[model samples]
Target: MPSYLEFFAGGGMVRAGLGGRWKCQFANDFDPLKVQVYADNWGEKEILEDDIHKVEAEDLGRRADLAWASFPCQDLSTAGNGLGLGQANGGDRTRSGTFWAFIDLMKELKATGRLPRIVVLENVVGLLTINGGEEFKAVVAALDRLGMRAGAVVVDARHFVPQSRQRVFIIAVSKTAKIADALVRDEPHPTWHPDPLVRAVHKLSGKCREQWMWLNLGAAPELKKTLNKIVKSNPVGVDWHPPAETKRLVGMMSDENRKKLAEAKSSGKRVVGTLSLRMRPSNGRTIQRTEVCFRGLAGCLRTPKGGGSRPRVIVVKGASVRTRLLAPAEAAALMGLKSKYRLPDVYEHAFKVIGDGVAVPVVSFLRGKLLTPLLRSIKKSRAADDSKARRVARGSSERKRRGQLELRV
Candidate 1:
């Protein structure tokens, strides 16, 4: 079975997407809460609940077929501090700076001849433009230095789920691995290669550009589910806002959003939409306003660190409109997780684990379309080489036996 090492494995969502086909050789994360959640779902046999920097290459045991890192994005996300990914050689000490530690680990693995055949890095789409796109180049360059060919695609969770979370997946393959021609393209696909990513690729240094790959993920699948389908009407762990509070929520809506609410109420049918509070300038003073989206999709789930960033569910049926915090289970469903997936009991802790994870279906799509096929090709190639070597050795042995018989005669 193919094996992988999952870094920054929040709640083991990647393992959930990888399914039982792949063996998880090692998993690491620094947050105690996230580690506990991951252990609850995936067990603690392979999990190391410690900081990435503290992990040594030897602790990873045998080399894995793939290494997946969904590193901290706080420094690289647009909503974050924009500190970038520090230095390529492990200089910075910020949250996102942990990326350098991952790189350093890969370098150590390579030195010890334990480097994985493939490496996948997942993070916010803002990674493509952070620090004027220099950081993206540095990442590709780092892979290049490891003698790997690197390519990336921007995958939005909306394609596979009801959430509008867009993340960039950087897939790097060892230069020695066998890759099928069908898995690459001369140009980028419009869906996966947005303008920012295209620009970032074009900006790579000449040497690194030579190793760049335009991965062909093929066509995106149609979204079969919507926000309404994923959201539970009578969600548990959260209560609906009282009449006065609900009125206040509606009153905070801007004129445009209020019109949307009015339209929903007039439809005479139930409407489910997501609400978020944004600070908008009014009369030269910034005031908080509630914005609602009725496009059958939820706004991207985010860590509920503060009140303004928390997402709310708005249900409008005829003249009555109700609002409430989005349930934890609903958040998990939005990330393509099954209902049976275990989550933390505390609401904020559960939201943090779910929000700070890769969409399960997106990872599954990449696994089926790219990673699995690539690994199969590599295995096939190695098997063929082994068979040829065995035949050669047999021939040599037979000749030696015949020579001995002649000498005896």
Candidate 2:
């Protein structure tokens, strides 16, 4: 089995996507809550619950086939302060600087001839435009300097799951590896990158562009899954919003949203459920806004701070109208995490874990189409070399035996 390393490994979401074939050689994360959840599921033996900068790559005991970093998105996301890479804004900026530390480790490993064959990084799509897209280009250039063909694509979870999360996946392959192009040179990939990522990649400098890799996984133009399909229709014993709370949610709606709710009520349908709620400035006053989705999809999952960012599922069944936070299991389903995956005890922390994770099916798609095939090719080449070595050994042994016979005669 190919061994791997995961840095900033929150809740082991990457492992869930990579499946059981790849062994996690090392896991590192600083958050105790996330570490606990990861240990509960993947076990504590391999995980190192400490600051990643403090852990040396040499301490891993063996070279990993791959290394993945789903680094802290807090400094890179728009929902965040957006200090972004290479800025000096105190510890938050220093925290995002951890990416450079990861790069440093990659450099150290490469120097020691222990560099992983593949490296993958996941983060919010905001990284693409941060610092006028210089940060993204610098990252690709950094990987290129290490003699790896780096490629990036923005994948939306809505394509594989109910949530509308668009994250950026940057994959780097060793220069020695041979792999097929994901994106066609002259042709456009309408499904994979309708616009943004392809555009950004085109803008790469000639040298960096030369080191870019592409893999065509044949993603669909869109997905058929729905939010209602994954969410619970009848959640018993959970806190359902009372009439007073439900009235507040309804009264907060704008005229257009109110009309939509009225229309849904008059349509003779017994049930209608809305996915999200937002607080926006209306006429200079902060007002709550909830737009019931007609599209059968939920808004992106976010860490529900006091700002009311966590989405609510407002259910209007028959004469009863109710609202409740999307259940933790529901959030897991939205991220394509399996039913059996263990979540944190506190729902708030659980939401943070789930919200920041990569969608499982998205990772699975890459694994099946890009990662698995690339690894297989490497293994096949190694196996051929080993067979040739064995044959050479056998021939030398036979010659030695013949020489002994001749001498005896």
Query: Best lDDT goes to which candidate?
Result: 1
Look at candidate 1 and tell me the lDDT of residue 36: 94
Across residues 156-200, which tens digit of lDDT does each residue of candidate 2 receive? 878888677888889888777755443323444565555667767
- Candidate 1, residue 112: lDDT: 89
Query: Model 2 — which ten-residue stretch has the worst lDDT?
Result: 180-189
Total clashing pairs in model 1: 0
lDDT of 1 at 265: 92
- Superposing all C-alpha atoms, what RMSD in Å does each candidate have to the true structure? 2.2, 4.1
TM-scores for candidates 1 onward, in order = 0.94, 0.87
lDDT of candidates 1 onward, in order: 0.90, 0.77
Task: Residues 1-409, candidate 1: write the lDDT tens digits.
Answer: 9999999998999999999999999999989999999889988999998889899998999989999999889988888888987865544667887888898899999998999988999999889999999878888888888889899999999999988999999999877776789889999899999899999998999987877889999999999998888777799999999999889988999889999999999998888998888889999999988899899999888888897677898998999889999999999999999989999899999999998999999999999999999888878878887999999999999999999999999
Which one is best on TM-score?
Answer: 1
Clashes found in each candidate (C-alpha, N, C closer than 3 A)? 0, 3
Q: Candidate 2: give its CA RMSD in angstroms.
A: 4.1
